[model samples]
Target: MTVPGYRNVPAQEWDPAAPADPAEAEEFLRLCYTEVSRLGPVEPRLAVVRAQIAATGTYVHTTDELVWGARVAWRNASRCIGRLYWRSLTVLDRRRVHTADEIFRLLVRHLQVAGGGSAIRPVISIFAPARPGRPYARVWNEQLIRYAGYRTEEGVVGDPRYVPFTDAMRAMGWPGRGGPFDVLPIVVEVPGESPRLFELPEKAVVEVPIAHPELGWFERLGLRWHAVPAISNMRLRIGGVDYPLAPFNGWYMGTEIGARNLADPDRYNLLPVVAHGLGLDTSHEATLWRDRALVELNRAVLWSFHRAGMKISDHHTESERFLAHMRNEEKAGRPVPADWTWIVPPMSGGATPVFHRYYHEADQRPNFYLDSEAAALARGAGVRPALAAAPLAA
Candidate 1:
């Protein structure tokens, strides 16, 4: 699981049923309790935590610990350059939520709270952790907000990137309206039950209609995007406890929507279309048609979000804030692990300060990671029996 240029980075185990490493688990619990004590009066709770660990090989976190763990996880998220405001994240402690229907309802509430009229706030709704014997609840969506992709006689309809998910949804008896902007229903998998799809109500979603400040023609494109990107599938490992249903969010970075989602060839791939609309000579790459179109597209995204009164950060300001974060971490004697490929802005990579530097390749604990099992389920694969077993709490 080592990425290129990163030395000594080990891939995290993704299997939910894999036995926990006792030594590593013990170290993680020690760090958790130490952090909790530093944040508040947890001396009494420490005894309970230790006893729980002794009996179960894992410990329960107080509400304060959960909040701290979630926030620190964000700070330790090497792939996210937007961690400058990690302290601002809001944690919705939903660890008590168990059923798929309740999970869907809370997800709706998460969208409502985070998407708060484009004043977009960072939030994470943490569900139950996988105990030693019990399988925890899991959501199958990459993000809470995504459009349905449909297969058609003409070609792929809507977003091509979602075809697999869309096909999977169809197999689950979800027949969408088959439109370009159809919102996909969320699929929640509970232990010992069939995975179910829950449709998102229109009132819960906030989308910004994209338009350029000056380019009237851009409005004709009818492009739009959801306000918040609440990643739902990444497993949150805190103090040896794995919460498979923790969905967290942050305000959008303009490049995420403009330079990648709308511009990547496998996605909407609007660069060529936008170039033609702008009358740019697409005859050759030498003309820099793609580059020129990208700028305007990014401009539209920024302008649209601003006009809609939504929270979005331009790459320049975010990069500067990231450097400030790095300095603060260094001053505190904390090592900052970053993935250069992700730390650098998607557009104008070399032009940004982050692009010129090398980052520590080591990964930190209490971080978000992709789970292969969750990914396979999201792709509509048949449920693996092992994944359905309830996690056994020691």
Candidate 2:
């Protein structure tokens, strides 16, 4: 008898009513016996597999009960995939191993006993190394050891392999492997309304201000204002899941030196911007940090597109505000600052806490805001245009 669910006839799809002819079943049984015969099976082990199944009752059913049964058929294949990756590692010791194909066969045997195929893809895609370290079984040994025992932060930062990094990297949906160590971007997406906090001391209402006239859409909704440190990175909650969306690296706006040197800062000034800064998966985080220091309200700067006045590519499909800035600047011909240098440190622990170490000030290339010089000159002095009245470009 063949082990139940381990091997089945290949069909376009599974059908419970399908009954294969007895002759075909007999031929399938002969095939299974012939397969086990090659593995050092002399006359004595002519058909070790079928006899083993006969004695073990492993072949009692034709189809599985629920999803697990439907999945058992693919278990052997899953382990092969796992071994395929494991054997590909160039860093592992190659002297002790057999052929890569044989190693895969043994690996498959060990994994197939459970819901093999169904479990492998998620594990591999989520955990398999984007880069292999070695070419031997040691790779599997290390992985199993760490997985069996949690040792990542125990000072055993483990082999900087692609699995762990990619796991964190997967959160950003940027599966892009090793192009360049570029700046990290974090994108948060909220639907209908901004995500909220679960427990506030005394359940106080939190108000996030809409500083830019361009973002009055936030106030038109129901967002409130709250004062926070300016040197911090963005830490927000979206879809009921708490997300720590900080700049992989942080910069400040002003410092003691000259107020434009790049200083590494921590996550600060955590607040959601208007609909503009939501739903991005890059490692970069953009927060709204008001620039003014007031008891109730103040001016803020969005650190991500801190170049709020500069012009991005006009060729982009989603490039609306960016292109508008360019168009307005070209009309003025003054050429806003094309460069930026974050300066100044965020004040620390006081009525206002900003870390001065990370302050930066970059030169502006072509600043174009209605509130900016162009905006001031276009509409006239101190006359703010209705930001809510403007529509995002088509």
Candidate 3:
């Protein structure tokens, strides 16, 4: 059965060996400059870019160009329902740093900066772009913060979705605490170096303990989740250049945790547990026990986050905001590229405003993409064999 938002749509393959296309650079620059009038005309900038691409294989993006390009990349993210605030993304330029230790340090800072206060700001830290025919540094973790999953004798402990990944980390000498919510170490790999594991300090990770507003026993379940959903492995492509290690984040919508992460059968699979706790009859589907449990679980997630003073949005409110974003984009005479499967909320599809409309589907450039190889690595494929020969680095 095809999952609602987790469709296996293939991303357009990127050839790392190929030089940056001057035409793509021109197209992006023209749009970028045209949108922001204060940046002035694109003619002079285009001339320099063309000349540089002719001489060298690629042209460097100026700070202004990089900033605008990152924001536009967020704007062009088709799967994201929160693109209404794309312009408000905090772009951290980390193009100069390359070492694993420094990169790890900055990543911790990125989380603190993003989730330190109650207001979780949307942030992206763009690392060095992949030069032509050159390997670039990247984080192996799909998201910067995820709990470790351990497969034991009886069944899987913690999140079953990450069991393979957790096993791979253990193979690489990460002594994972066999606990439900142990934060997995960040594996950073630079060119010509072994992937090193860096444990996230307690201060770097902001977590909200899950508890229903009224269910007193819900706290005993000991469920919690990280605040920031920073996707670390997706390649951030912008203006003909690809930043393989640009980790970006936005505050989570309640349903993402309640309906998908915690409730998915393959993940935490909390529906049955919650239903049992609620004393609902699960002997028949006609009882609608799962639906009742899902609603209550989602309510708990939203309530917990709100009580913690963390920024979170409900699926209903976010759907309305997405429609507002589409209207705003329409006024600008721009097409809003979106996937119908993703734009609609996974839990209540018929109830949301975005569910009723068809959207333009386009592979717009200056966007983020999950390369197949990166996805494989994130899921713990090719890890044991690749790192088996190399000694674990500090």
Q: What is the C-alpha RMSD of each candidate to the true structure, in Å?
A: 4.5, 28.2, 2.4
Query: Which window of ten consecutive residues has the lowest lDDT sum in model 2?
Result: 123-132
TM-score of each prediction: 0.91, 0.15, 0.96
Which segments of candidate 3 are over 4 A away from where they belong?
A: 1-7, 385-394
Candidate numbers sorted by lDDT from highest down: 3, 1, 2
What does candidate 3's lDDT look like per residue over 266-354, in tens digits? 99999999999999999999999999999999999999999999999999999999999999999999998888888899898899999
Q: Report the backbone clash tally of model 1.
A: 13
Alpha-carbon lDDT, every model: 0.83, 0.22, 0.91
What would the per-residue lDDT of candidate 2 be over residues 1-394, giving only the tens digit for each residue? 1222122312122121222223332433343335344434333332442453445422221111111211211121210111112112111111222333333332222223211321212211000111112211111111111101112443221122223322332332333323211111111111222111111121121112233344444334332222111111111111111111111111112221111111112111123222234332333433223221211111222311122331111111112332344345457462322211211122322222121122112222111111122122111131223311222110
Tell me the lDDT of candidate 3. 0.91
The local distance difference test score of model 2 is 0.22
Number of the top TM-score candidate: 3
Best by lDDT: 3
Q: Work out how many backbone clashes candidate 3 has.
A: 0
